[model samples]
Target chain A: MRKIYFLFASLLAGNFLFSQATPPPADDNSLSMANTQGLLRTQLTLTPSWMMKGTSGNDSTSISSARTNVYLHGTLEYYWTEHFSTRGDIYYFLNKNSAPGGLKKNHSLQVGCSYHFMKGMSLDPYVGVCGGISLVQISPMDFMKGDSTFLPNYQVPSHLDPVWAPRVGMNFYGQHVFHFFVEAQYLMGTYRPAIGPILSINEIRISAGLGFNFVILHKEATVRPAI
Target chain B: MPYSYYFSKLIDPNPMKKILVFAFLLVGISAFAQDRKPNKNVGGQFSLGVRSTISLFSDAGSSMGTGAGGQFRIRLYNFMNTEWFGDYLMSSIGTIGTRTDYHIGWSVMFYSPKQKPFKKYHPKPYFLTGHCFDYTRIAGNNPFYQDPNHSVASRWSSAVQAGLGFHIPFCERVDLSLSAQYMFHLGKDITAVTRTAVNGDEFLYIDKEEASINGHLLISFSLNIRCADLWHDHQKKGGARKAAPDPDGQNPKHIEQ
Candidate 1:
């Protein structure tokens, strides 16, 4: 406990020192020009991603084939100045899968800044990092009670932990109205120990999705003409 | 033997009244001594306290038994007296929604007091009786569609308890004690919210009472003040008169002596 406290204290001190030493970048001269031209249009997006998770580590002790889990991912983004924008993503996984031992559900909320490299193109590539919390539930019934004909179920503990995932993905807009995209994220760090008999398994995956954007109010086609 | 005969008669079938009488006698004696002397030296003392405890256990899946709770105490009464006490407790367990469990209960105690002025160490037994309110939350997910009815009363209830405590004093005012107790539920029937099961063949309800044993381990610290100081001045005056011997070195035995 003392060691954990000391480590946390040092990390906080380091953050303070780095933040104090760094200074904001000089303002971009082109920002004003872009704002006046009206070329800097803001875009709002909602992406629903499909995720597939796997259990590694002590897998043999549990079921033979890990079940496939399905969850939805939502994202909202604002275009700041052309290629640079910020995005916030929310993940909701509700009762995705339940076995004899316990149930596993995932709910995450993250806000981060994203940088878009391409402009005016159908394809936009972006990279971002987000931090949030993950709630996992592991029921003992999953492992304690199972049929002899079937494989033994492995159960884990119920826990809430901090989650940080860095992601790199692309957004493809085909035909201007329909859009499809895919991203691979590495779910890292276990704030607490894994529950149940499986103590070694930690990292998981959040993968792939498709979405669409509807322009509710577009910029005027042209300024009104005089008589 | 005669003292025990009289003490037993004082407590026979009327413990509360006996205690009241004991308190009154002590106060009257202190007042009488104060009228004779005005100044005397009195020492200070301390006590140690503890409580017996009980807990009701529950899970998202199963229906268990009623749980228990209690407290224990080892206290120094004065320079010469020490006490030990214990209590028994009981509580009800209920589940909220599909993930949380709540518990509530109360307790009663019994104690004994021991006095040993000449010895360096003393053993005291004490008892206490009172009530308490307890709450607990257990978080998890319910996948089996079991106990679909998630209501407050269906999730929690309260119980009552009674028990014994043993205590020993080590210093002027400090002591150590341990206790064991049992808690019984006043309400035996379980209350729960009911909902239709996924199977459609049956309904599920979450019970307010858990089926399990409630037990606990506790450590306590306490302070005790001896009332001997109330008569210190009287003792001092009596001591002075003794120094001035009468013709035959005989003196009337007063209450202060």
Candidate 2:
């Protein structure tokens, strides 16, 4: 019994000694001093967006007149430096209107750059301006000649309008590969159809979702940690 | 790189979404490109790629059309190039009418003198002019119309287009281009006009217009990859080595830790 106990203690001591000599594997989540150069981030989410008041560009002043639109939003961003990044976003419309003469489609693509506030922290806040195009179409509304008579559908054309937006967002990085982001964008545009009144495409959109971070070009870890 | 937990969650439920994500992921992974230094001496190169286009402001009503096509480029000089392309486009006319177009054309591209040669990250502006042979068909959505001849109309015509475009090269071998051109068709105009009946019903009528010239705008976006060098310019090969100075301003072999 005494010999067996001695053997077990010796084995335990040897294992502990060997473990200290070997360095632990590098953790991806472990904060370091390396610069965030050439990092690529991608995200996709379904966002429910509301068109703000006065979207019709008409005399109507009601704030809640327009309907809510849902879009499949996809984003691709690249960090050129620690504080500046280029981003492109695509919003695909995904709603079928009930009324014959309502918004048929509202799709947009925007590209811009953002200035990130936090340098090395897991949480980052940013502000940006983007310019792009919006493809919009409105179905022909029913023309009523009498109290009950309905006329045939009149076709209104689609317009690809130039749009610009200002955006503010926040990103919270997870322990390793994931990050959560939420952003608010105020877009402005006007759609000019061949026939009919000009329509305003101004709206406020908000989206929150998860994203993946990838480092395409790794930099040297030479800077000393602040702590 | 480790796969994010959120990615797996987002991709787990829908197989279609999985395919979409995978397709984008492949594009992201293949973003790596060879570093081609700016060659001042080389005048010729070759590239091939696919492009997508949006046709707008057509005379055949207000509906916009989306199209996909492919193009190949042959650079004869540092400032001159040529592109050959083919495109098939389809658009809806009003509510129940449709228009289909097939175009095959070639364009001569002249690089602007102000552009920096072989700079990958900068935008290089160019002017292009081209001519194309096209076939257009306009048809009514209704099959059992009263007039069979009025239901469908088609024409074969030729068009000329001129546009200003810019190329943004991401790497030595890959570039993205965007251009907007005004295409004028020289053929019989097939026009769709909306008319209202005495009963307050509105309908579309398809007929040939009195005018002979048709015009529209074409916007194109393309991604191209350099594949070959058709001609070997010895001076350009030598200039490349001299052009790329050391980023660190030190001999790479003699750098100290």
Candidate 3:
């Protein structure tokens, strides 16, 4: 896991360095990614996520053995400047896990901004943080006869907990109507229920797919008097 | 009814040919029919927008709620604007109850400094005040309130909100805005009660309380686009009209009047 993370970080760093040296391609009539002001990007795809480095569950299976969670991730981002953009993300709970005390529902909605590093190139890289709310619920543990279930059999109800995520990603803008992107986010949240033990809902989520972009407004051009 | 029309129709092989010709004629008529330009009048710039809202600090729920809605703006002046909007929000009260709210409202906004049309890069701050009619419903599925009599409650109320916000124009046609407002509703309130039994069982009951007022904070972020210029520019209504450009965006030949 550490090596994977290190490799991803190295790739991002290398892209950042390369983007600074690269310039927008000349003689291109298609939409220029370098002039990103007033561009809106919308994307929707299924993202597979896993619980990593969080509090343990009450079930027999350890946290590491829990089933992966799948979510429908939707993103809407708009560039306010060449190097700054605002983003809103929505993660809808899609699949349920069969593991004991697994996630019944895990959904979140967040809004934040990112700062683009290679603002003048088609390979756009950035880092950002977002804060939002997550609605999380864990499945009820099994009840066995002649078993002392009173201790861990607390009523684990759904909770709306505050969540913050720090993410890193890159967008490859190779066309006017669509682009490709891959992002990874480490979400931090704690589900403190009214009647159960505190469970950390921290997870690392990754998603990559095509997204569509719309140019809402074009920059004004200088006009010369007609002679 | 014309002789040429009948002659062409008689020679056409398929009726679809006349239909296609009519469609092309309609397109040409629609293309050259509009002579209106962007209005320079006060409150002439019209915009349509969508927003996401977070409802906070309400007695009905313990956690903040999220909702989405849309709005439209009509500029009243260089420094004033009006917004019409509607929203639907849902919130959960722990494990006991769920609450849903519907709001339809209108607000007037006044820019701190007179704003120029299509300005970019800087934040345009404004103050706003509005009134809205809201409907709220709260229901519980717990055992204590499972009976049809006491399981659900709903109410209708009118509210007024006032707040300040700012807009950042990313371009000439689009702007992103953030605002925070406190809305106080004037009517009955739907209250939720949680009771714990001796065996650590929790039950929730929902009921309509006496006529009273309640308030909550609403934070919203929205993106708006200038869709149309509704009114004619008073400064240019009788003056020389700007020369129309060709279809390819080139200036046409200027003909002497």
Candidate 4:
């Protein structure tokens, strides 16, 4: 056990040092303009957004409950030119609830698409729809009492089914550097049980947070010759 | 030569061996009681302990069993308490010969700082109540298997336990304790069921209830280290020694005199 712990510690230290070391610069002129356009135009504008959400839902018992859900929403917006752009949104949701006797944690991955109403606006409003599968985990204690039994509980079989949802939100860009916005999304799906009746599951979430966009490449200025 | 033969016969006699064993038992009990002095300043007070029974007893002899499960508690008051707990058990039968089982579960407990004592060992009894979502899988060649089609039951059940415990100070801020608890399954029948072979071709279902009493027994040992102390300084304000006696006999004479 001691040797294993030391080995893990050394591996973690090596990873940390490796991540901190800078990489050598590559040759600039060998890079093609098309590759540069693909990298700077699409990759640079693509920003990853993270948001914390709170959700309330009803179980099979029809009891009202609340859960703290944290999700990472990453959006990649591509512009064929400046005016025509398409945005692809991917979201990952993790929900955790600490109940009286046990706890339940669920993880879901979703991908969707959206079309912005006005192009190049600091505050861009968009409407989109998403669908993906969710993995639901339920932990229940047997003969114990109170919250102490919540931890050592068993994990039930995962629920695998495509979950479809629609989202609407506006991204508010402030000072061209920071963008903060809130969005509401609803998930509707049914838990296909391996045995027994099929149960319906629904979740609604509202989230808002800020993010920064880094300029990896700046457009060069054009100078006209004196005619 | 004759003395050696007689001595060997006396030492090897079977009836005499039984008598010697009885005599040893009599002496051991008496010696144990004499040494059993009530612990004094070894204050075993203010403790919470929990235990999960790995084995369960049912009323029916059919031997359809469930895994042992439970929780523990030591609460000085309504708001301040420490808890330790365990997960629900899954039952299974072994391949070779013996009855074996498995339980996959988790537990966590926390204590607020209000209920503990400042200087003395305080033992407080607490009540435990919680729900256990059990995924019990039972497999055995026993004749009393409950359901062949569905060997596992996924259901949510609740439990309650009441018990007394004591804490012995291990360090200035650490204490350990041992406690006994009576745990009861509030709802559902605690019975094991199995299928019996009938006429070599047909199978008949048999439900066995073993120890179907409302509750079962549990014993637990726990260690507690003080996280935060509120009144340690207040107790120190008074000298460690007992207060000096008053001259008046109105006060206890041992101190007053």
Measured against the true structure, the TM-scores of the candidates, in listed sequence, are 0.30, 0.54, 0.61, 0.30
- lDDT tens per residue, model 4, B1-257: 78989966765444555657866886776676673222111112243322223334242222222222233433332333545555333222221011222223322222332333323334444333333223222333222232555333322334455555555443333444555555554434433344335533222232333322254444544444434322221123423323332333343322100
Tens digit per residue, CA lDDT, model 2, A55-88: 3322433222367888899999877666767678
Instruction: Give residue B94's lDDT in candidate 2 (0 to 100).
Output: 54
Q: How would you class the docking of model 1?
A: incorrect
Q: Which prediction has more favorable TM-score, 2 or 4?
A: 2
lDDT of 3 by residue, A74-148 (tens): 999988667777788999988876455667788898876777887646788989766677888777764332344
DockQ for every model comes to 0.01, 0.07, 0.05, 0.01
**What lDDT is obtained when candidate 3 is compared to the true structure?**
0.71
Q: Enumerate the chain B TM-scores of all models.
A: 0.35, 0.70, 0.74, 0.39
Question: lDDT per residue, candidate 1, B1-257, as tens digits?
Answer: 78978956654553456557866887787777775432212212222232222333333332222121222222222222223333222222222122222223323333322222322234455454434333433221223333233332232224444455544433332333444444433332343344644544222354556454342322222222222332222234434422221223333221100
Q: Which regions of candidate 3 fall more than 4 Å away from where they truly are?
A: A1-34, A37-46, A51-66, A71-95, A98-118, A126-168, A174-180, A185-204, A209-227, B1-42, B58-61, B113-119, B141-145, B235-257
- Candidate 4 displacement at residue B213 in angstroms: 55
State how far residue A181 of model 3 sits from its true place (Å): 1.9
Residue B80, model 3, lDDT: 82
Higher-ranked by lDDT: 1 or 3: 3
Q: How far off is residue B150 in model 1, in Å? A: 34
DockQ of 4: 0.01
Worst 10 residues of 2 chain A by lDDT: A55-64
